[model samples]
Target chain A: MRTAFYISDGTALTSEAFGHAMLSLFPMKFKHRTLPFIDSAEKATRCCQQINAAASEDGEKPLIFHTFVNTEIKHIINQSQGISYDFLDHYVEPMEAELGIKAQPKTNRTHGIHQDYNFRIDAVNYTLDNDDGVSTKEYGQADIILIGASRTGKTPTCLYLALQYGIKAANYPITEDDLDNLQLSYDLKMHRHKLFGLTIDVERLQSIRQERRANSRYASLEQCQLEINQIEHLFRQEAIPFLNSTHASVEELAAKIMDEAKLERHRY
Target chain B: MRTAFYISDGTALTSEAFGHAMLSLFPMKFKHRTLPFIDSAEKATRCCQQINAAASEDGEKPLIFHTFVNTEIKHIINQSQGISYDFLDHYVEPMEAELGIKAQPKTNRTHGIHQDYNFRIDAVNYTLDNDDGVSTKEYGQADIILIGASRTGKTPTCLYLALQYGIKAANYPITEDDLDNLQLSYDLKMHRHKLFGLTIDVERLQSIRQERRANSRYASLEQCQLEINQIEHLFRQEAIPFLNSTHASVEELAAKIMDEAKLERHRY
Candidate 1:
């Protein structure tokens, strides 16, 4: 059995992301553990002892991924029995050399409260308030408006964009009424330049809707097929940019939408 | 003026995080650009040309942070007239050395649809359904239940935990009646082991509430003070672990809660 440890002085988000990426490359089962907020030398020392114990008990060296800003804490953890991969140590020097500037090793700055925190909070609120076309009176406030049939992965994508990038994303569900006429809503037409469409395969849409309401007309394959066809036709006729959500994850869809829309990510 | 470019073969989340961390160390205005899904050699070449042009126009080397899985694409982008910091290039070798395995250069694997994707979607659904103590019947399903007075930053923290870590989090608001009685709700008492409390300064709570309802008694300083005092006392009486949310960001609060509650982060 193998063990993987993610350690950091803050939330360990960076270490976790890098560790997961690297670990997924290998074909092995791993017992993942996370030790966050190891900001002090004492905490680091205790964490190292724990890691060493795990290594000895497992009869294999544990893989430790760390992003410690404090040199002292990082040094202590590095002396542990496990094979350590210090994320900051590996890349910060190269970045400094390339940019001709020294990076300030600030702990927790990646997710700390900065000038952009309020912007992120406001974006989340905006996305929640404007979700599912609940309120179109504030369409002008959105950076992008996602239009799609229900169960096309719109709400989660909007929430992801708003939370991750602080982008004010609002979503509107393209109902049967709208799809039948092949016309955009008056509010959506006013903001046509900001519209992005999402369409999914009939089978996937049927399956998703089935989970919500089993054996209903809304979850029927014929209904899903009809809606998808009409939506795609409307998109092509209106010259609106759209993507297929059947194969792409929410993160990919959000990133692609932001790129196609030329929306700037709000720095936080 | 400075330009910071974050490039990647897939979502570019890693590049964006590292670039933002490095840029925050410097106190200067920067025009940040994100270029994601550069999955081909042709796209890489075009991106390098853009970087070179930006460098020449700015009269200073632009900073390019990248995580290209394709070696050829990485080589092409590295040759651009800019300072390049490749996240994967710097760390992959050491990992290979430690693990005795070659890292697979897979694009879009970091945020792909894995087994954990459904877990995250379910967690988000769970959080939304159980938000603001609207439905406590399913407290058994929650990994952690956050309790606080109104405007104590519970909802956002719960959502962050759910979205980022795929943890099923539910939140309860401590109303004036509960505070006056200085007792936990009957439903919450049943799940005492899963309870985590949040407290905020009276002024901060008042300000947050004022934004929702201005000049009302509920948003007044006296009400905030009374509720905070009672809530803290209730928390102490019930032996519930809690944190002050007045100064901590949502990310920090979520991480700390997970740590203190010994809640495992559900990997996605």
Candidate 2:
């Protein structure tokens, strides 16, 4: 087993993204360590020690994926025993040439707080307030409304939309009570344009609900199938756009919804 | 403003991360567009047209940051008028050589559903259930607990932890009522090692709370100052680790806490 390090003078998020994408190309696993905010010479020296230690312990040269604005610190890490891959180093020069602007490298620029930061916080609060059909009053303010039966991956998807894209996503759970009538509420009908639906395989939904509420009717296979059928039918009859959550992660679902809904992402 | 596109066969998240980091180095604005799940040849052709249109409209070659696994799709995208920067292309060969494994290029592997995927979803559910001092009974299950004053950036940070790291983070808000005593509750005492304090500048806290509750006492500077003072005192007396969230984004705060707390990010 080898080691992979994502080190940076800032949040190291971009480093992680780059390294993770790169590593996913191979079919092997390595010990992962992220050293973030390593802005000082002293910290960089200590990071070198960790890299060397990992090398000695594993008897394999560690892989260092780093993005550093501070040249002195980057110089120190580049001296370590690990094989260095500065993902930004290759592109920045070409990009600067292409854009006719020199890259003014700076720490924290990648994930720094900007003017749109407040919009993300506001979106988070809005999503939380409107989660799980808690209130339909703020549907007018939502960028998109995700409606689905319980355990169909609504709440997490809403939160991801808020956190990642600054989208005001409010979710309504189609409950057992709604299984009978299978009709949209007055409020949802009023905001039909904003409505997007989610459906899951009966087994997956049952397994998820089982973990939450074991052996209950809510977790029963029959209940799960009936609910998905009704809700998806409702989506079709009402002409609501929807997706299957059975095969998607929150990131996938959020991005798909953003693309399909053609919503303006408030944050870059 | 020139347009910058983050396109991919899958989520396009890595493309966004790489492109954003690269673009942030230049002091300019870009009209950002993200095209995710462009997995088909037809979608690739449409994407090429969009890129060509952007190039013509901007009167400059648009910046395209993309990661595609399908070669046919990637080839079509590469032929677009926009200057393509497939960040993954430059490194995959080198990485594969070093690892002695042929790169298994596959779509969705970067942001795919996997075994650890459930951990993230579960973390999201746990964080949501235990948010904003809502419940403490489940604190025993939390990997880390964030204690903070109102509007000091507790909820969003916790969600980021759960979503990004698969760390089950629970946040408890330290209210004005607790300002007088400013002592750790019994439950907190039992898990003092898990507790991480967050403090914000009085002015920022007041302004943030003001947005939530217009003119309430909670939104007053004096009240915020009082709570922060008592909370800092408690943090010092109890030997609890703390960080100031005043100038930090949720990503920064979460990364800092993960570092200081020596937290193992359950996601790679």
Candidate 3:
């Protein structure tokens, strides 16, 4: 049988998706297999050796799709004589060429120049910095603070903004205690001008919460309704620009925040 | 103030990611905003109107990055006066033309003859009845199944697959119960062949779990090691091919499965 091996250095998810997508598009068919290696260069080399041995024993030239960033694995594969393999570098190289930007497809950037600002901003927001029992002036450092009940897509939106836009986004949950108080976090209130609120339909929030907590009190529809209404009222009374996350995706919500905050989308 | 609107039918997360990625490569900065609307014709029209108003008020022809798909929005925008916009259709059309594909960039499939047999095989695999109950025989019906422990990137991988691929993949946790029981769920066993497992290093899983539930039994080093060892033994014993989810993206994970399972990847 004609064989195609999908070798992965990190995870093989993208490779598998692309392989399936490509197989669907192409008219040809081949026996397919995947080998996902962890952060080990040695394991990747061993896997390559296994593939080469299998191909040689079968006396068939196997088509290999190797996806990895480890130079050791690459060197081993390049030296292998038994199997005919193609690297995914061919498919990804063009996108960079066309886009006129050099993004390392395999190396995920945690922080650097040309990284998504939205991701960085969110990363900065979630980190805690406290002094004694009281909060410090950390709130003033936030570019924007998102307040909403759990399951309102606050965290994801904050992350997307910080990771993709390089905007420093912070988010706080409107816990039952916060709802009862009908006020922003004490620390957040100090920087209330930068605070934004996210409110979603109780029914929607309930459904989302249910996915995580099943039958917990936090996932209860009644509790969701009570909290959403109180949060909305508090946001309006306090004049925090609020958004309904009922039907919006994280991308949509972040977009709404950028619009309302009049913030420039910092790309690089 | 030059305004740029990134409008999309997708969840705002993707819109913002694409917008930010694109803008990162651009040379100049503009007043950026994202406006997300549900699949309402009126909302789309109103968004177009808002773009026009914003552009006119700013006295600069705003570069409206329209990520939406409704033809009516395009029709309305084309009919409107004094605004410039870049539709995804036009943006990818030249590229499509260069690629010699008569199909549009957005349209996924062509109407005509049967294409790849491998995709047809995947279609059949989902339909085949299995004697084992573990087989989500409807595994084909899964948007995505994430098989991992408490913190082996299962949830994020699942969310990414669902959000990015729009695949209806379902995820099942491989708990101690499943392992002690010596088999996956009846439905999963029946669809065992369709099941794609995600494996990660014990240390990595522990660290991630610790972030969510610190100092707990589930997050403990010894507990994590045992669970990982047990789960890995089960995967190996069952002969279920798996991937390590460490440092791999959801895109890569889902792609790997699609490739391994030989499923069709639909265009967004």
Candidate 4:
């Protein structure tokens, strides 16, 4: 198999995202074996061993993508008798020339700007009324409120917006209360302009929710449909902009939101 | 004051990280303001308004580092009057090129054979029993295990390793159970060679934990001290390789881990 690895000496999600993106851009001639992490000599040995075994069995070598960071493992693998792989660092050097301008710094006015933005996103995640004595202000302070039913990729999307962009993105479940009321929270109403809605295909939502709380009322497709319809109606009535979260990756959706909202700019 | 907006029409943290990295590389030469998460036309207007108001007060011009993905926002910003800004898309060209090479598909298997040797390093922040959920029977599966206490910079380190290199990294936290037992899980013990520990300054750990847990028992300095001591002792007893997860940023840590671990080389 033409295996491709998206390995890392650390977390591989981002790399995987990039890798997937790259793969999507290109013709898939190879069987991709994207590994997100390879952290030790032993692990390297095991990978080597597996490759060797695979080679012996198939009477041909399988293509491996070595996305890892440990040098010792590199050395062993480099000196290894067999197996195919590629390292990403060697390929990144050419791109350095594009960053012609040097990065600049922050001043007094920029003091703890990160802290402020982070707090804003956290503020939005907190449920004020029913919070378990934690903090409510953090959730309320969110610059953007994401409303959706459960398993609509709301948390991940909000987190992506918050962690990657440093935007204060808060998400609240369009709970039964909100649905029954046929309206959003008073707090949300006050910040209606900052509200964005995410809707997904019923099947996709059900599958995602299944991974978490399974066969529950919350994960039910019918409930999802009802809530989605109610939420969509509410969004229409309130004139809040919304998107079909289905088929849209977090990156695409975040880009769409930012483009549409023109959220305030900050000196990152 | 010269105000600059780091408008992220996308996720802001990545922009912020890039911004911080850039700022560190090149210190600020002008009065600057960093406004993050400007995701819409109106928000952009509001940001401009704020900047304009500030500029009127200081009689200075503004510079903006707009990190965006929405072509529409770019169009609007391009149309806006008298805003000085640098678009990140113009800068990321080189980085993208390098990523392309690393991610390119290989047609030749002879050379690609030994390329899967690179190992990944994971910087675990909490007490995880195993490296993700990947089983040990899959010995060839893990790249590395980063065992450490909270706020040990595990997440960023892992991310850096993966982003900078193509390594598959999995992290597991060394929880109280692991520490008290003075042993890792049966699965990990079997794959001990893949285990790497990340330690940080107790004070630093306390500070990081404080941000997440607040004034809880876990965030206490004394608790931190005791847990660190226990974990360290356990590491020593097990003869596990380890790193101090303090002072160094993500880039530095990943580089060091790669060098130390001798991660395998990818032939391709």
Candidate 5:
């Protein structure tokens, strides 16, 4: 198999993003490697050797997706045997002309600390503190509160929202007791506008719960069906917006919620 | 302020990454907006109207960085009153020729559900369960274990590692009592090869602690200085690699640790 390298003078995150996006369009698999923080002439020389080694060992020119603030360093990598795709380089000049400003390339600018850094950390802490119906007192400060049947993927979705978009996401689990009444609590009712529901197929929920508590009544298909049935009914009756997470990744669920909730992301 | 839009038919994560990476080059602020999940011609028409409105509102052509798999939807967006930069357009043909294959574009392919999605969820659960020295019994399964003084940025980095790379990262916070002998515990010793350390500036550590407990002994600068001193000494004596998190963001820290440890990432 051919190899693909993502190299940069800083975090190499943008290079990885570019390469990954492009590679996803192809049907075949490649060996992926990332060489980040390559900030020196010596490191660039060593990187060239690695690229050449991969080329000879794989009997094909490796694909290199790289971003470098230093032209000399970039030139060194370009001299290697690999096929280099400087994706951003093709558009920077046109963008400069359109924006009427010269580009000031700098290392680490793409994924560095910014004024919004504190917001991300604070969001993470807030999400952790308010996870899994731990406390409803802080619901007033939440940007969006996710309520769903257990094992429908509330915790990971909340963490992704906080970590990626800096959204203050808190989640509450709808359990067996809540199933009897099938009503939103006063705390959730007070924040109804911020409520978002998640539901999963009964078999998916049963399998997930089975891994947690094997052979228990909670993991039984009957119980899973009953819980999902009531919770989804409650969502429809209360006019709460919701989605099925049976086939969605956490990224998809988080992005969909951010859009449907119309929440302004405290973007990085 | 000028307006810049990131639009896509799916989650728009790739569009956001591409736009943010490019925009970070210019030293100017622009009002940023993201329009995601615009998969229909009707939604595309609405998006164009919004783009035109932003153009009229800002008195300039709004800059659009978009990726659309649907040609009809792309055509609708192309009619908008904005300066469009179809970034990936220039490279696909050349890459296709190089790889001897046709480019197959699909919505949500860049950030969609994949076989490795389960690894990410499991890693997140593992990281949360093993957070802040909560349990060392699972250290054997960790790809990397981060050790540092409290409030030195262990939790957020671990979460990022798990979410981004699907690496099981567990963190342990070194407290004041552990500063006496400054020796690794038996559990940590068993997994010493997987250990990586983090340190921060005394001033920053004190301020972070101060927010959690103001005017407390643990938040004192002198005390923070002492703990950092002992921890740094311990890392050097034990030949453990460490980095200062005072100036690094979570992305930077996670990437650095992954590179230094040379752990294989379960790429998405």
Candidate 6:
């Protein structure tokens, strides 16, 4: 059994995300350890020792995935016996050459909270307050209004967009009544330019609803099918771009919506 | 004016996050462009041309921040006139030398959604269902229960932890009755081990509350101060680990809670 380490100068999310993605491609049985906020040289030395110890015990060099901007700390970890894949060192030089500019390397900056932190916080607040069509008081302030049948991955996607990109996203649930009427709500029509729709596979929708209310009409496959069909039809008729959320994760959904809507992420 | 580009073989979040962080440190005006999912040699060639054109127009080399796993793509982009900072080329060789293994170069693996995507979605569902002490049906299933006064950043943090880390977090608001009585709810007491408290500065809390209901008794500064004091006292008496969310962003708050509680993020 081999060991894999994800180390970073900040929250280590990038390293962990990259490592998991890469490991998924290879048929390897490995134990993974994540070490974040290794911002100092001393911490880097200790990390190297840990990696070396793991390598010795396993009798196989461990794979280390790292994203560190600090050169001194990266150098110290490079001396470790484990095979390291440093994210910054590998791509910075070529990018510098391509751009005709020197790269600026800094530790713990990638995930640090900057001046726009408040903007992200406000976005989160706006998302929560406007969730599930709870209150339309803030609709005028929303950057995007997500409309979907209940449990089509609207709330999670809205929160993800808000938290990650500081995008003011508000989600409105498309109820059975609205689907029967086959019309967009007056409020949605007014803000139609900001409206994005989400739909899901019938089976997935039924299963998701089943988890909330089992063996009921709401959770029945037939009901899910009817709702999905109407919602897709409404989307096509209204010319509002919609995505099938059954196969897409929230991140993919958010990215797709942002790209399609030409919505700029308010990150600083 | 200068052009700054974030280029990547995958989602480009790492390159964008790093570039933004580094640029924040320097007082320079730059127009930023992010190009994600540039996974092929053809895409790389097009990106280089865009960078070159921008450089020629601006009469200054544009800054390119890139994370590419493909060596050929990286080499092609490096030949461009713009200043290129390639994340992979600088560190992969040293790491390979140290670990005696060749780096597996692949694109778009870092942020790929896999089987764990369902787990994250389930977590988000759980969090939203249990938010703001609305339902105790899933309190028994919560990995962590965040308790705080209103407008103290409980809901957003719970959502962030769930969406970003796949942690099933639930939040319960400390209402006026609970504060006046200075006691935990029976449900919260039953699962005190999972209870985590959040407190904010009195003034901040007042302002946040004022935004929701301006000039009301509930939104008064005195009410916020009284509630905070009571909550802090209750936390100390009950030996509940709590953090001050007044100055911390949701990301920082989530990380601190996960670390303090030793809760493993269930992300795949």
Per-model B-chain TM-score: 0.95, 0.97, 0.54, 0.53, 0.98, 0.91
Least lDDT summed over 10 consecutive residues: which range in candidate 2 chain A?
A174-183
Model 3 ranges off by over 4 Å: A1-194, A198-237, A243-250, A258-268, B1-144, B167-195, B203-225, B261-267
Q: Which CAPRI category fits model 5?
A: high
How many clashing pairs per prediction, in order?
0, 0, 52, 96, 0, 32
Task: Tell me, by lDDT, which candidate is best.
Answer: 5
lDDT of 2 by residue, A1-268 (tens): 9999999888999999999988988889899999999999999999999999999999999999998888999899999999889988889988999999899987888787988899999999999999999999999999999999987899999999998889999999988777678899888999999999999999999999898899998899988888888888999999999999988989999999999999998887
- In candidate 1 the C-alpha lDDT for residue B110 amounts to 82
Name the runs in model 2 displaced over 4 angstroms: none
Q: How accurate is candidate 6 locally (lDDT)?
A: 0.81
Q: What TM-score would you report for chain A in candidate 2? A: 0.98
TM-score of predicted structure 2: 0.98
Order of models, best DockQ first: 2, 5, 1, 6, 4, 3
Mind giving the per-residue lDDT tens digits that candidate 5 earns over B1-268? 8899999877888788889989989998999998989989999999999999999999989999997778999999999999887768888888999999998987778777889988998999999999999999999999999999999999999999999999999999887767767789888999999999999999999999999999999999998999999999999999999999999999999999999999888865
Measured with C-alpha atoms, the lDDT of residue A266 in candidate 3 is 59
Show where candidate 4 strays beyond 4 Å. A1-138, A185-194, A210-221, A258-267, B1-25, B29-146, B153-178, B185-196, B209-222, B248-268
TM-score (chain A only) of candidate 4: 0.59
C-alpha DockQ for predicted model 4: 0.11
Candidate 6, residues B1-268: lDDT per residue as tens digits? 7898988766677677556655644545687877776768998899989889998899988888776667788888888877776544455456456545666765566566776788888899889889889998788889999998888889889998998888999999998888778999788999999999999999989988898899999999888888899999999999999999887767778877877788886775
Order of models, best lDDT first: 5, 2, 1, 6, 3, 4
lDDT of the candidates, in the order given: 0.85, 0.91, 0.57, 0.54, 0.91, 0.81
User: For every model shown, what is its TM-score relative to the native structure?
Assistant: 0.95, 0.98, 0.44, 0.53, 0.99, 0.86
Candidate 5 residue spans exceeding 4 A from truth: none
* Tens-digit lDDT track of model 1 for B1-268: 6688999888888788777766766556677888899989999999999898888888888899887767899899999997887666667777777777887766778877777777877888888889898999999999999999988888888888887889999999999777767888799999999999999999988998899899999999999999999899999999999999987878889989988999887773
State each candidate's chain A TM-score: 0.94, 0.98, 0.54, 0.59, 0.98, 0.91
